[model samples]
Every structure is written in C-alpha cells, then in structure tokens.
Target: MSDNRRIAEEIIKAVGGKENISSIAHCATRLRIMVEDKENINQPAIEEIDKVKGAFYNSGQYQVILGTGTVNRIYEEVEKLGIEGMSKSDQSKEAAKNGNLLQRSIRSLGDVFVPIIPVLVATGLFMGLRGLVMQEQILALFGLTLADISDNFILFTQILTDTAFIFLPALVAWSAFRVFGGTPIIGLVLGLMLVSPSLPNAWGAAVGDVEPINFFGFIPVVGYQGSVLPAFIAGIIGAKLERQIRKRVPEALDLIVTPFLTLLVMSFLSLFIIGPLFKSVEEYILQGTLFVLGLPLGLGGLLIGFFHQIIVITGVHQIFNLLEIQLLDKFGNNPFNAIITAAIAAQGGAALAVGVKTKSKKLKALALPSSLSAFLGITEPAIFGVNLRYGKPFLMGLIGGAVGGFTASLLGLKATGMAITVIPGTLLYLNGQILPYLLVNMIAIGVAFTLTWLFGYSDKEKKM
Candidate 1:
C-alpha cells in the first residue's frame, strides 16, 4: 500500500479503529476528532506517532496536536477514509446525548473561542490596567506625565488588540488551509489582501459619495478589515484554489506559479464578491440590534441584561462588539457599558455565595480571591469552578444582572470608554448623572448577593 494510505490506517487504528471516530476536523496545529468513545482511543499510542505532538480533550472534541505542517496532511489522509457522516457519539451512544441548558451553553461558549480566548482576554486586561496606570499617573516616577503615558500605552494596546482583527483573515486562512489539507501560505496571501489597509482606503475613497466598489463589471466588493465571516469564507475558497493549482502546476515551477495564480484569483473573489456580501449582512444585523434596544427600558433592559450572562457563558457575547463599535464610532459612547458591569457583579455574587456556603477551608480560600477577581471583570475562575459547581449562585447572579441592567438603562447611563475593570472605571462615565449609575450598580450587587445567599444556602440545611 502507499505510504499516505498506510499512515491513514495507522491513525485509524490508534484512534480505536475507523469504527471509533465519529467525525474529524483540523485546526492550525491540531486534529479535532470527535470519537464515539473517548476511552477507546489510545492517547499514548497516538502521541507516540512521529508526527503527533500530544493529545487532549476539551469542548467535547478529542484534539491531537501535530507540529506545524503535519495537521493538513493528516487531515487530508483522514478524509479519504470516508468517515464524514459518523456521529460524535457513534462509538459510545450515551456520549451523544445533549447536556442541560446551562451545561450546553457553557460548552458552546468554550467551543466557539476556547482556542483563541487566552490571547483575547490577556490583551483586554493589559489594555484596561494600562489605562488605569496612565490615568492615575502611576508611571510619573519614570519621568512620564499622564498624557505621555496614556499616548504610549494607547498606541501599544491598539496595536495588540488590532493585530488579531487586522490579520484575522490571515489567521483564518492558515487555520482553514491546515484543516483542509492545503498549502497555508497560499491561503495566507489571499487573506492578506482582504485585510490590506491600503485596499480599504482605496476602496473607501473610490466609492465615496457614489456607491460601494464594484468588481468585474458587476459584483459589488466591500472593504474588509476587522471582519470575521468574510475572511473565513475567503480562506475556504483560497484553500480549494490552492489544491487545484497544486495539481495543475509543473513540478519545476509549482512553487512560484501555483501560489501566484491561487493568490491572484482568490484575492479578486474575496474583495469583489465575498467581502461585500458579508458586510451587507453585518450591517443588517446591527440595524436589527438597534431596533431591539429601542424598546421600553424596563422590558428591553431586563431581557437584554438577563440574557447577557447567558450570552457570555456561550462566548457569543462578542457579538455585542457590533453595537459597541457602531456607538463608539458614531456617538463617542455606548449605553451597553452598564451591561458589562452587571456581568462582573453576577460573577462576584456567585463567588461570594460559594465562599460563604462551602465548609472546606481550601474551597473558601479559592473562592475568596476568585470573588475579588470577578469584581475586576476576571470571572473565569469563579464561573468555571465556583458558580458552575454550586448552580444556584449563577442563577442568582443572572437575577442581579437583570435588575442592575434595568436600573442603569432607566437612568440612561453611558460609558465613555470600554474598561473591563469597573469600579474605578465607572468614574469615567460620571458626566452629570453619576449618582444614579453608582446607585444602580450598588443595587444590582445587593440584589445579586441577597439572591445568592438565599438560594445558595438554606438556614435549615448544613453547609458543605
């Protein structure tokens, strides 16, 4: 048998045979495998493979890491085994059953961005703390005034945050290409054009006051920067194009000619067809959100506020970026800022509940600091370990979040900037109605705390 076929068979056997795998996909450096029985797969044997780095499971996916370029090749080989229709629980029927609403929501959240969240959170926290330091003149001892420090910090933070968005096309291209078993460099080049700063400026200026840019005598092309879906579509197209090009190009000129043709065609399609189509959809979604938020503050705020924690738990809360970005760009402020404050408060409430209810000193120690961290908008530890474990605390937090959100909306509180660290940052929103916002926040926390205490602990029941 051929070497590629042999490799595929080896992988199939290592993963508990072709019967054990339900489905498979690949990421930048890992094979995302869905197995019928996770226990059936021999992780150590898989890791021992020359191309494999390690293996682990998260978000209901069995992941096998393979250094750099191996993922694409392995993914391609696996696809030929005709295992595409296998269910995630085909091997172990019990595994495929759905979890509860909260469990499913949390799992979905982790699945969507768990691979990318560490960098996103770290970058966010860095920006928030950096702003505080500059605002407080904490770096003045280094001969830097507040203005100077702020400028420098803002520049650095912008670069870091923007990198992910700006080069998002490239990241998606690389990941998708590897997943589909194609040359990533060709996909990367195609992605680069979509995010190219010069292209957006040029396109924007060209279409100024007339209409959006048109491509190839008919198709409309939109400028893509900091967009998610368009780049993903483009990457998929680019990978397919690369596969075709590789087959047709001569061995001697394949390196140079294949990439050139793939990039040229993919870039054209991305800019002219894919990018503009997605942009229009994004604009429509934003308009829909505005209409929804325009409802009466009591119902609108309560619903939005109540579901906000649920959204965060699902990790699709980043969808809120559309509202925040639009408001920031047009109005220089956003009212949705109060929603985030409530989210932080909910985590704090839940953590406090866990701390008070748990009898184990070790658990209390962990919960205490976790509560403080949640108060500062760092809620993973509390959410994953405490609130989730104790269940009632999380529900109480949502109730608190809804009440707080409603009060803030009623007061028409607006945030001047996006700051994860809330207590001190709340001052930034203190234009005229400072007291109302403060009162709203305090009330929200109080409600959350009371609910947590009541639901999380029973006077008649012994503490754990």
Candidate 2:
C-alpha cells in the first residue's frame, strides 16, 4: 500500500477507529478532526505513526500536523475510507464551539490579525530592500551618493513600505468585522475615517508638528495611522451595533437606516471615547512590553525565548500579535522577532540532532523534514514529531533558545518587521543587520543540535 494510504488507515485506528470521528477537515498543514470522544483516542499512538508530525487536541479539534502536501494527500486517502470531510467553515464552527472564553478570545484575536500578517511581511521585505539600496555603503559600491537617487523612485519605495502601516487600521478593522460577523465594507469605511486626511496625523501630532483637533474643548482627536487596539474595538462595536440596529429597523429601511445609524453613532463614540481611551491603553501595553524586553542583560529575551514555544503549545501565542503590533507601531523595530526566531531555530536544531542520531529510517525521514519546516519558522512538526516526543530534546531546544536570545539582546538585535522568522526572516534583517542575524541563528541552531545529539536522543528507545 502507498505510504499516505497506510498512514491514513493508521490514523483512523489511532484516533479510536473511524467510528470515533464526528467530522474531519484539512487546513494548509494539519488534519483537523472533531472526535466523538477525546478520551477514546490514543494521542501517543498517533504521534508515533511515520509521517505524522504531531497530534494534539486544540480548541475542539484533534489536529494532526502532517506538513503541507502530505496533509492534502493523507486527507484524500482518509476520504477513501468512508469518513466524511467537512468544509473549512464547518470545521471552524465546530472548533469554535469547544474553546473556553480565553481560548475563544485569543483565537478571535488570531483570526483578526493573522490575515493581515502577509501584508506586513511583504511590507517588511520592501522596507529591507529599500533600506539596502539607500545605504551609503551600498550606494558607494555603485559610485552613487544618496543625492543621486531619484526622488520619484524614493517616493515609490515609500509607497511600498508605508502604505500598509498607514492604513493598518483599515486592515485590522476589516478583518475584525469579518470575524465578528459584521459588514466588512462598513468596517473598512470606519477604519478609513480614523486615518482621514482632515485630522492631524498621529505621528505629526505626537511630534508637535500639528495639533490634534479638540472636541467640546477637552477631547482631542488625531488620525490613527499605525494603531491596533482602537481599530479592533471599533470593529467589534460597529459590528454589534449594526446587528442590533438590523433587528430593530423595518426591512424596507434596514438597508439604508442600518448602515447610516451604525456609522453615525460609531464614528462619534470611536473618535471621542474608544479611540482616545484605547490609545492610552495601547500605550500602556507598549510601555509594559518595552519594560519586559528591556530587562537587564537580555533577561527579557532569555525568558521569552525559553517560554515562547511553550506558549505556542498552550495555543495562546496569538496574544503576542498585540505586543508585536505595539512594537512595530511605536518604534518601527521589533526585537521580539529576533528573540522568537532564535527560539524557533533551536527547535529545528534539536530535531536535526534526532534525525542524525536515530538508526531508524522511519524516524530519520520524519525528523529531517520536520527540522526543515522549523528552520522555515513553522515548528509544530519539529516540536511534536521529534523533540517533544523524545523529552530531553525539547528541554535542550528551550535552553538553546535562552542562550541565543541572550546573545541577540547583548548584541542588540532587532528586525525591520514581524511575522516571518528564521530563514525567510532574514529579509527583515537586511541592510546592515545580515551578519549578526546569521550569527544569532547559527549559534541557536548550533547549541540545540550539539546538546540534543549529546544527551537527548537514544537508539535504544527507537521503536521502528
């Protein structure tokens, strides 16, 4: 039998047979199954299957991390076994019903922000590329000075790097509205109002280049260009209000009246109350994060790096999106990126050690690919399929993260962007940061690999 077919059959048996599954679906990298009873499934057996990266119960679904192409193929094989497959939307609804308040909240935040990360990643790459060409050293190599650069070309580069952040509220608001079941277009309009040209820009107002417009003599308002919390709050409020208004208005008037009242009332409340209040709250959050990251001797990085993947396992790592947004919004440099990349790289290193030391060809196959995925900044496979399963490698990976994080902090490493980390993350460290970025990753991977090879893996424990 083909590997995927055999793996699929093994999975059904491991999860307590096909009778225990309520529904199944596949995302980009996982097979999400809603089981009839969690207690019935053997998670260890599932994780031990060849090509199965990891298995865990999350939200309301038992997710098997099977990598990208493998998941689609395995899922197809699963379908051939007579188990029904659900749509992604249906799967989301099923999973949504399972998490507690905190899980749901974090998941909602993740849902809202995750869609927007690609834009930011692309923008960061653009920023790095722009910075690269603008450097005096790079320009000197071309025998051209900064003044020789065309103003039009410079303006175009600014458009690429600045557009996403300049309209970030719109993206956040739109995403939030979609997640909260509101009209996304209305949310987009609302977000645009927050950054309207009539108001003084937030950056300009902060630097005192322009004064904020005051309402009722005390309430001050400015354009929210690089804001997060306010936009998200506005989206939720707007969506809720729209839903409430829709229920009250007559069908004939609903089309016109619902949007009108939603916009009118929400605009005032958002600008006067929500925007101002949450902006301060966001600032406080930003300050608190800075305090943690700024701890003496990189202790902050050490702590976060060590615990980062642990947080990922608990499924609350989405909350870090807020901190990262705050960092990018305030300082334009994200130290968190550097620290987390080290943490992620260490997992890959540890997994690689397992691949090297194991005599079992089945394990070698799983370990090598899983390690590659971790290096690309996706760590579920490495963490679940290899390191965590082996016990000692997971701890070794954490220690590697701590040491690498300290080096990053001591050397003052930061990235031009967020989201992308490890290898593709190199884009964020361009311009002048290439060497230190490489050094930090190498050290992290090196430490984890050495430690795991020496102490984490054992051929005696290999079952295959």
Candidate 3:
C-alpha cells in the first residue's frame, strides 16, 4: 500500500478501527473525526504515526493536526477507506441537530463565518499591500505619490480589494443557505438582489453621499453591500421559506416555481423589513463595541487578549470578525486586530517553549511546527494540538497574551487591516508604523515565551 493508505489505516486502527468512527471531516490543517467512543482511541499509537504531528479532542471531533497543504491528502486517504466524509457544514449540522439551543446557535454562527475566512485572509493581504504601495517612503523609492498612480489602475485595485465586502451579503447568503439545508442558488440570487448595482452602494450610503430610494414610494430602502447580520437573517428567512415552498410545489414544476417565489418574496421582505431591522441592531453592536474598547487603561485589550483564544476554541470568535469589519468601515483602522495578534503570538510562544522543553519526539514534532504556524497567523495546530492539549500551557499563553494586549492597548496600536495576525500580520502595520507594531508583538512574544519556558511545561508531560 502507498504511504497515505497505510497512515489512514493506522489512524483508523488507533481510533478503535473503522467501527468506532461515526463521521469524518477535514479542515485546512486537521483531520476532524467523530468517534463512537473516546476510550477506544489509542492516543499513543496515533502520536507515533509518521507525518502525524499531534492529536487532540475539541468541539466533539478527534482532531489530528496535519499542517497546511498536508491535511487534504490524509483526508482523501481516509475517504478511500470507505468511510463517508462530511463537509464542515454537514458536520456542524449533524452535531448540532440534537444539541441544546445554545449549541445550535453557536454552530449556526460558525456556519456563517468559518467558510468565508479565506476571503478575509486575502482581503487582509490586500490591505497590507495597499498600505505598502501608498506609503510616502515606498512611493519615494518608486518616484511616485499616492496620486501619481494611474486612475484606471487605482480603480482596478479598488474593485479587486473591495468586491468581497461590496457584495458580502451574497457570500453569506450562499453559505448560510447550505448550512440551513436549503437550495443555495436561490440564496445567491436573493443576495444579489440585496446588493444590486441599481441600488446605492453601502459605502456611499454610510457617508451620506447617496440618497435612499423610497420603496413603493413610502419606506426607505438601501443596498446591504457590506452588511453581515442583514444577509444572515435574510438567509434564514429565505431558507425556511424555500423549504416550505419545496414541500408543496410539484417536482415537475418545482425547479421553475420554487426559486421564483423564494426570491420574489424574500427580496420584498428583506428590503422593507429584515434588512432595516438587522442593520439597526448591527449599528448598536458597533457602538457598544467601540465604547467597550475605548475604555481607559487598556482594559479592552487585556480582557480580549486573555480570553480570545478561548473564544476561538469554542468557534465563536467570528463574532469579533463582524466587529473588526465594522470598526474598519466606521473608523479608518482596527485596534482589535493588533490585540488579537498578541493573543495568537502568546500561544505560539507557549508552544515553542513546549517544543524546546519536551523530551519526546512526538511532542517536539507537534509543538515546533504548530508554533511556526501560529507565527504565520494560523494557530489551530499550536493552540488545539499543543498548548490546549496541555492545559497549563494554555493558561500561561493567556497570561502572555493579556500582557501583550495591555501593552498594545496602552500604546494605541492599530492596523490598517483586519483578520490577519502574527507574521503575515506585520503586513498590516507597514505604513510608517512598523516599528511600534513590531515592538508590541515582540513584547508579547517575549512575555509569553518567558512565562511558558518558566511554567508552561515539564519533562513529565512529554510522553506525547
């Protein structure tokens, strides 16, 4: 057998063979398998597998950290072994179907956000690049001003950069439909209707540069171009409405009538009711977040730093994603981005210390790569696979993050972008403010490292 098959077989055996697995899924860096019994898992054996970095249980899955670019192959091998695989959405749906209300809500929330993270990551990179190209020094090196750039090229870059936020409703609607067990194409059409070019753009509306159109000559209406909550609520309405329609419509005419009715009904309700209601809610949330973060003496950063990773562990950190975007939209910068960066770096620091302090080859292999990944802005491997697996290291990382966050908050460190952190995060600070950003991160890393090295691990916990 090829190596991947062998590894897949070994994984199955270690997790109590094929019989014990209830379902399987994979994300960017881990194999998330649900098992019938945790007691049947051979943790030591799984840890010994070549190329398997580490294993841990979280969010009800037996997750094996496989690093970026490597997880897909293992997931495929596992699939070929005749075990059915599920999408993250499907997995969330199955697990949350019978869960408590809170569990279902959290799963639904994750469904709306996790699938879109890659786009946000790309947006963060663009923000970084935009900062670099527009800097006075960088422009001087190129013998140009911000205005010296060609207007057509500038518009092209603007389109490329803002398209995601411009029609963000469409993406959310599409994902949310699938999550809620409805036809996704209908969701796509509804999303497009919400952000049609005929309507005023969200940014223009925000700046009062465009007037709202009166719907049916009475209620005011505007496009939901950059709105999340509106699209999310609309998706729920559309999905439920479509499901109900599908039940009554004949299959012969189902394809023809169902989508038409779903879109026609949702568009009117969204433009007049749900969209307006949710937009107001989002505004209140934005104001509340701003007030909290603007508190004196860095309290916001300190608390967020100490607990952000815990939020990540529970998969609810995406709510802050909405806050970050709103902060960037209403203001010009995101202070929360830098604070979150410190939080992630602390986890990396703790993991690095664990790697250095460990005697076992398995723990060494797990911690080192995970720490490196954390520095690059992906912390699941380090957080779930390492620091969180050993509870003390997780707490130590939190302390380090709290200190770093407090420092950044006190210094009023801000980023030109959102959603990227750690190494790639440096890109967000390239505009004449690189030094202080670097200093803030360094302090965070140093504190976390010192604390982790001092208290996060011991030889006794190194058995893998």
Candidate 4:
C-alpha cells in the first residue's frame, strides 16, 4: 500500500513469497526466515533492495540482516502476507506443541523476557554495589556501620529487583495484550487474577505450603506470583475475548460493555482452565529439567556451557532464567552457573591468545584489555574485537568452555548464589570442593589460550 509496505511485499516475493516461507522471525538486526526450499528464494534480488543490509543461509534458516529500526516494520509486513501458518510447517513444531501445555502456552516467552534484561542488570548492579558498600571499612568514617546501610539498601534493591517478578502475571498480561493488540487494562486485570492474593498456591509443600482456594465452590485458580507462563496464557485469552466482545457490541455502548464482559469472562476461563493447567505444566518442566541436570553432570555441563555464549548471542538466554529460578526455588542453587562462568572465561582466554598472536600493535592493544574485560564478564569487546576478528579463538573458547563445564559437572560444583561480578562471583561457589572448580576454570583457560596461540598465529610470527 505504501513504499515500506511495497518493499516488504517485494522482499516477500523475492524470498519465494507466501508459499515458500515456512516461518519468519526478526531480531534487533536480522530477519530469520525458514523457507520450504532455499533454491526457491532469490538472494541477490533481495540483497539489492535499498534497505536490505546482507543475506546469508546458515543453520537451516535464511537470515536477512537489516539496519536498526527496520526489523519490526519488516516483520509486520510479513505477517500481513498471512504467513502465520509458517511456524507449523516445521516437523519439530508439532512435538514442541505437544511436549507440555506450558511449553505451548507461553509461545513467545523469550520475547516477553528480553526487554526486561536491562532492568535486571541495573538492579543487580545496584544490589551488588550496596553489598560492596556494607563491606567497606569507610562506612564507620561516614558515621555508619554495616547494619545501618545494609537493611535500607537490601530492601530497596529487593523491591526493585522483585517487582517485575512479584507482579509477573501483570507484566506478562500487559506484554501479551500488547502483542495481541488488545487493551492493556484488560491484560492487567487478567494478570491480577493469576497473582491475586486470593488465588490458591499450587507449587505444593516444598514451595512452603500452599492451600488450594476454590472460587464459587468450583473454579480452582493457583497463585502465580513470580511465575511466568500462566499469566501470559491468561493475557492472551483475555485479549482474544476482548477482541470478540468488541466486535459484537453496539457502537454506542461498546467502550464500557465490551471491556466489562471481556474481563469477567476471561477471568473465569483463566481460573477454571488455564491457570491450574499451566501451573502444573510449569512444575513438571522444572522437575524434568532438574532430573536431566542430575545425570552425568559432566556431559550435561559440557552441552549447556558450550551453548551458553551462543544462546546469549541469539538473545534467548533469558529463557534459561526460568530454569535458574526454579533451581533456586527448589535446591537453593543451580548447576548451570559454571556454564556462564566458563563462557566469560573462554572470551577472556581467546582475547589473551589473540593479543599474543596478532602482529598489528593496534589489534594487540585492543585484544589485551578486551580480554581483561571478558574476565569481568563483559563480553562485547571480546565478542566483536577478538572472536569475530580471529574466528579460531571463538571455536577454541567453545571447546575450552565445554571442557571446563564438564569438569565442574563431574565434581558436582554448583553456585551457592548469583553474582554479577565474574571474579568475585566465582566465590559464590566456594565450599570444601572449590579447588576442583577452580582447576577446571584454569584448565579451560589454558586450553583456549594454547589452542588459539597454536592455530591463530601466522607463519611469519613463528619464524620471527
């Protein structure tokens, strides 16, 4: 209809149009297309388009990397082409759909989760700073002791950190409603139902005794405070119901009557059907995950750790937060802590290797300091400067991380608590068996450093 819309139509046609596209998703900078056949898509034609940055086929998807602020508009255009059925074209989609109700219920949980990360990071850092201040000897110099500052800071950060989660249903409800193009108020009401104080607790005794509450002597709704998927489900239902009611209502009374009926009906449906069902599924997923993690810890650790960095790159690492939170709730700790630890170490290790191997003084200088930053768990410098530049270092780092993860898993090392600072965070895992994990950390670094050095260096450098 317009230039942007025309461009989207043209791009869709270039990618073999509606028939060829099996599914499509867009990240901040890339359009990921799953096509029925790669041969059907016209690559050069799409790339030749003014806004299209680049195109590549990898990991069984056709990726069109775009400039900033272009992805959403492109995605909307693709949706207008009636491509919603594309995701179901994949064979795995059915299995993914059937595996668990909660799995199907929270369709785009990652999408809902990712936008909140900056908030999480900010609050975590604030909390960490508060802890650091309390440990400072200068507290007394300011006429304050550890006790004076600790309570206030702790409460402040806890409120900030927990607000999103405590009212998780409301957040998910709002996000889901927005996604479905419904009223935020409708979504908010649905979310409140899930996390309402009157709702029954379904996480059982291990979760500190929750009593099942009955509404009207029939409908059973569970407490969903700090829970993710159930509220999302409720929100979707509420939005859909709202859409339907809006269409049926008379123009004169549509505003008030539509919302009133939508909220009332949706709330009842969520309580009777969606809330309890998703809560059960969430609990099952938690148990299944823990069971998997308990198996040959080394192999589990290796797979999980090796993919941690790669997962972060794709912006889906937040999906793992559900796992981490479940673990913390159940066992007071998590095994995948080492996965993140090793991923950060691998970046550092690779950067160090690059610093030593590269001939360019500028490159070396950048690599060395970037490597140090990686040790602090800041990965952008290492990812862009070292990994993307050298390439080999990234692969080496993956291998080393897998090795380290395996070792930590074998020793049954687990994080006692979460830490934002990588170096000091390692101490979170401290116990009688800390040495084994430390050794594993060292070995991973060693392997990455040695491999990168041997493979990354040029012949001239060796001869010199």
Best by TM-score: 2
Model 1 agreement with the true structure over 205-277: per-residue lDDT tens digits = 4458435455577875544655555666676677777888889888999989988888788777778778878
Superposed model 3: Cα runs more than 4 Å off: 1-3, 43-54, 58-60, 214-218, 460-464
| Model 3 weakest 10-residue run by lDDT | 95-104
For model 4 the local lDDT of residue 343 reads 68
In candidate 1 the C-alpha lDDT for residue 417 amounts to 47
Question: For model 4, how does the per-residue alpha-carbon lDDT over 129-238 read when each residue is reduced to its tens digit?
Answer: 54445554657678887667656667876686456556767777886786665898778877887777666543452365865667679765567776666776777677
Q: lDDT (0-100) at residue 203 of candidate 4? A: 49
User: What ranking of all candidate models by lDDT puts the best one first?
Assistant: 2, 3, 4, 1
Number of the predicted model whose lDDT against the real structure is largest: 2
Estimate candidate 3's alpha-carbon lDDT, on a 0 to 1 scale.
0.84
Q: Lowest-lDDT window of 10 residues in candidate 1?
A: 87-96
Clashes of each: 3, 0, 0, 0
Q: What is the C-alpha lDDT of each candidate?
A: 0.63, 0.90, 0.84, 0.67
Model 4, TM vs. native: 0.63
Q: How accurate is candidate 1 locally (lDDT)?
A: 0.63
In model 3, state the lDDT of residue 382. Answer: 86
RMSD of each: 10.8, 2.1, 2.4, 8.5
Estimate the TM-score for candidate 3.
0.92
In candidate 1, stretches whose alpha carbon ends up further than 4 angstroms from where it belongs are: 1-188, 195-211, 243-253, 312-337, 357-363, 411-441, 459-463
| lDDT (10s digit) by residue, model 2, range 254-349 | 989999998999899889999999999999989998998999988998998899999998888998988987787778788999999999999999
